[model samples]
Target: MDEVQVVVAHSERATLRVGDVFLKVDADQARIDIEVEAMALAPVPTPEVLWRKPPVLAIAAVPGTTLGRLGGPSTGSPAAWAAAGAAIRKLHDAPLPRLSGRAGRDVDALAVELDAECEVLVASGLLPAELVTRNRQVAEAALRPWAPAFTHGDLQIAHVFVDGDEVTGVIDWSEAGRGDALYDLATFTLGHEEHLDDVLAGYGSDADVDPEVIHAWWSLRSLLAVRWLTEHGFDPFLPGCEVDVLRSRM
Candidate 1:
């Protein structure tokens, strides 16, 4: 029997890889429902659903490696990054899902949540107060209204798969929902800002994009994710990582 490889193990969910199959064990049924439905509605490439039982979703692994890893540099070529951007553009252009359970983030709630999270970081002494303050101010630009599109709420580079210059698939649809189109673009290039031009070029001339807002989301996401990553036993303080992302805002 092939050994089961733990891809990621967190309290809310876990992913295991055994041979060519990836098993997702999620305690939250609502999130699972959203993932399955979102994958079905998505027009781009995604992992093949093998079967589903309550709390466990099995999918055939897609070929190729992730576009990049968090807390690390990306080896993906400019063309591959652009391919990812094109895929996101296609996803944003697709018709919105009719399902009522589309997940999203509200700016007003985000403000309150950011305040509370910053307090936690400050009180815990996990980060310098000035670092948190500057990022918060930088993040405010993304708090404005945006026309919702079918967005992969957590469109990290690691979620995108690529073979050479072609994007083979995108995984983790749990956070997929109606949200800002630029949020996806911003999320993909969070740690890899140099690739933003290639991505935008691939995304083409359909919609206007705000560079400031993209940068804002970068600061906001890094600030908000630092604590979550640490709690989950992941390091956000690695060199040129989430912490650096916040500091770069200063």
Candidate 2:
């Protein structure tokens, strides 16, 4: 019998692994539609879709370790990071998928959410008001218009998989859609800024991206995730973790 591994479980969705297959269960049918569509449109490697049955989608596991973890050092070589970068570049360069989910997310709306979350962080006394304020100000740089691309809306380090120097697959596509290109880059390197250079090197010089915007996203994402992580029974405040990321920006 294959052991069932709980990859992730939250109020909104859950992912389970059994043997070589992954079962993603989501209550939102729209999100599943977007994931299936985005995976088909992506030019880079994504997990093979085995089947879909309404609330559950089954996919064959890609044979490779994740590129890195959120609060830890990446064991991936610079080349692997570069390959992942190249893969992102390919995805960003592809035609934008027509999806109502998270595509064309409003920057003003993001700023509003950031502000609300920062208030929660401060009122809870979980983080210093000064730290939250500074990051919030830094996040202002990302609150501008951007040319939409096929962004992996949540491109965390753990979502990218690699074998040796080759990127085998990218997972967790529920947030995939047309959005800001820099958002993807920032999400990929959040808390792992040290590897940004190698990733950018592989991404090449075609993109005219602003470095400040990328930095802003780091602050914004950390601030937003910290509260949700805490609520979901994951401690983002641990040392060398999401809270640490917010502090590092100070």
Candidate 3:
């Protein structure tokens, strides 16, 4: 393996190499005969697989730093945000092989889980039926074609690999699917409302994404989710329960 010494120490997950195929971890989903696809990297915290070209692609992980994010979004100028958005535009339209399939997601399992949660909420009268309805509407709108273009299913910032001021590449190809590119773009721009124009300008595509649907899912996650969690007495410190459970489609 070619050693690219870019850090002082390496984490268990960090391995230095140049163009060598990484061996999948034993029992890891990456090990199975499944493909990984490109998706818009969102702001959520999840393990992602980022790629870099040459020169600066090499990395040496600092020991004990693996548990957190690498270099994250810039709090500086909107220009940096603009750069990220532009990079995402390039990534969305790029063509490659389909990397994943929705085999593991169990429809019955999700129904059971959601039903139980809804029941508990109803039992306590903490459930806002309107919020649930809103959430459903949001999900439904985001569930389909926003326009004819490539889409990154799980568009978030964490999947974006930022080097210096530029997003070199994006990681995590798990939820990539063929659908409206706007859905993914909307997800990317939701939290960063201020730079919405920069994001739109970056998305140099003729296709259009449903703004209402984007607004709907945005509402579902930002409003209904908070309301539900507060009513259910769910603590952010608690284990097993993740915000992703509520916004799984994102």
Candidate 4:
């Protein structure tokens, strides 16, 4: 198999084709299919580098022009954001369920996982016990009614691609999981209030997701990321996005 040539590789397990029908490992194994296709939201091109928009599987191409991912996590422009917002509205119309974590492990539970994560951070001396407590509160608050859809586990500007008012692609699906849709939505929308509102408004009156739940999830999302960063030896600086979220919500 010849190596799959591209400017970037989304998964660590990504390999290049060396000969006819040969698979080589430059890194770890890729569990990409289950990870990204579990909850699809949009159409994806074949030989896809981005699967965050699953349900529209993109299989290997016959080879000709570039067929990998096009959007990026950091480079999506405002029009791209707008395009993404439109797509999100359409996706949210799906009949997804609410999370019941700490409640049970049935694909929608997030409470126990969040609690355990924060506790581990505290026990490891990475985060203050107070912060852990704050994280828990935020988590609890975020656990509310919001419709499910094909979600991007860690949806953000970095995962979106836009060209004018069109959404080119949705990248990254490693963290993809089932739960309230806003769990992903808030990560990208809340940070930019106006855009966030635009996204919400785009959903119109038909969407089942609750506004407060989205905000709560935004708070919880920040705490979760902060806790992870702290556990990984990052500083908990004041005025930081994480801190601001926790302080305001918790």
Candidate 5:
């Protein structure tokens, strides 16, 4: 029998891997429902659903290694990164899902939340006030209206898989739905600024690609993530992580 490997575990959810099968255990049934639904609706490759029993959903692992992980060096070549970008473009061009996703939140509401979080970060001394203030200013550029696209709300680098220069699949669709296209682009390239051009090269020219907005998202995501990450026992201050990404903007 294959040993169970803990993929990730936190208060909200846990994922376990046994051989080729992965079991996702989430307390929120709605999130599970969304993950299942989003995977079904997505045009891109996704993990095969093996089974589901209430809080635990099982899936077959996709082929290939992840493109990379945040705070670490990427083993994937530039072509692989571009292929991942092409796959993302395909996903963005797909039809919108029925449900609203995390990335699809109202801009005004998100701005309000961001402002509140910024205030907390400063008052709590979680981040330097100057850093917070500068990032907040940069973040304002992303608060404007945007055309919705089928987005992978949390397109972290680790979620994308590639075999050589071919993108095999994308995973973790719980946050998938209609949202800003650049948001997904920004999320994928976050903390890996060196590959932004390679990704954009394959993302194509027709899509509205704005460097300023992408930079704003880098700062905004880092600022908003600091508190939650710290509380969740994640060290965002590590070299080449969220804090470094924020600092790059200064």
Candidate 6:
């Protein structure tokens, strides 16, 4: 019998690993629907669906290890990171999906939400006012208009898998949809600023990505994430994590 391994668990969803299969248990069927549909439409490689039983959706694990975690060092070489960037570029250039992705939220709406979160962070003393304010100012650069692209939405470093400079697959399609391509880039490179050049090199010069905008997104994402992460029992304050990312901007 294969030992069950807990991948991640929280109030909303949980993922468990048993041998080569991963079981994702999510309460919201709509999210599950989105994940299934997104994977089918994505041009990039995704996990193979093994089975689906309501809240429990089983998928075959993709080959290769992830790029890295937020607060951890990445073992992938520059070529591997570049390969992941190329994969992302392919996904962004693909035809848009019907569903709006997590990154597809309206700019005005996102700004309002960001402001509210910032206030909460300050009032609750969760973060220093100067830190929140500085990052908020920096985050403003990302609020401007951008053409929509098929985005991974939550393109965390851990979501991209590579095998020796070749992208094997990308996982977690729940937030995949049409949105700003830079958001995905920023999310992937967040807290790993040293690798930004390598990633961009593979993303291509034709990508028209703005480094300042990507930096803004780093601040915006970190500020907005702190509260939710705390509520969910996640520590965003870990060294080289969200708080560190914010501080670096100052």
* Top model number, TM-score: 6
- Candidate 4's displacement at residue 203, Å, is 2.9
lDDT for residue 104 in candidate 3, whole number 0-100: 27
Weakest 10 consecutive residues of candidate 1 by summed lDDT: 96-105
In lDDT terms, how accurate is model 3? 0.44
Q: What ranking emerges by lDDT with the best candidate at the front?
A: 6, 5, 1, 2, 4, 3
Clashing pairs in model 6? none
**lDDT, candidates in the order shown:** 0.89, 0.89, 0.44, 0.51, 0.90, 0.92
lDDT of 4 by residue, 1-250 (tens): 3555532233343433333221323332233554334334344321343222222323322222111121212334444555566666555444442322211123335666676777776787755678668656656757654444555566765455444555555554545445456666677664554466556554455655566767777766765676655555544444535665566554
Candidate 4: residue 20 lDDT (0-100): 26
- Model 1 TM-score relative to the real fold: 0.96
Candidate 2 segments whose C-alpha is farther than 4 A from its true place: 100-102
Error of 2 at 66 (Å): 1.4
Task: Give per-residue CA lDDT, model 1, range 1-250, as digits (tens).
Answer: 9999999999889999999999999999888888888899999999999999989999999899987776676787788888888888999999977545765678899999988999999999999999998998999999998888998888988899989888888899998888999889999998888889999988987678989999999998898899999999888999878998898888
- Judge candidate 4 against the unseen true structure and give its global Cα lDDT, from 0 to 1: 0.51
The digit string of per-residue lDDT tens for model 2 on 69-185 reads: 888867889999999889999899888888655648887888888889999999999889999999998889999998899899999999999999998999888898779889999
- When superposed on Cα atoms, how far off is each prediction in RMSD? 1.2, 1.2, 9.5, 7.7, 1.3, 1.3
User: What's the C-alpha lDDT at position 26 in model 5?
Assistant: 99
Q: For candidate 5, what is the total of clashing residue pairs?
A: 0
Off by over 4 Å in 6: 100-103
Model 6 lDDT at residue 76: 87
Q: List TM-scores for all candidates, in order.
A: 0.96, 0.96, 0.52, 0.60, 0.97, 0.98
Index of the highest-lDDT prediction: 6
Candidate 5 lDDT over 1-250, as tens digits, reads 9999999888999999999999999999889989999999888899999999989999999999987789998778889888988999999998877863344679999899999999999999988999899999999999999889988899999999988899888999898877888888899999898999999989997878999999888888888899999998789999989988888888
Q: Residue pairs in steric clash, candidate 2?
A: none
lDDT of 5: 0.90
Winner of 2 and 5 under lDDT: 5
| Candidate 1, pairs of clashing residues | none
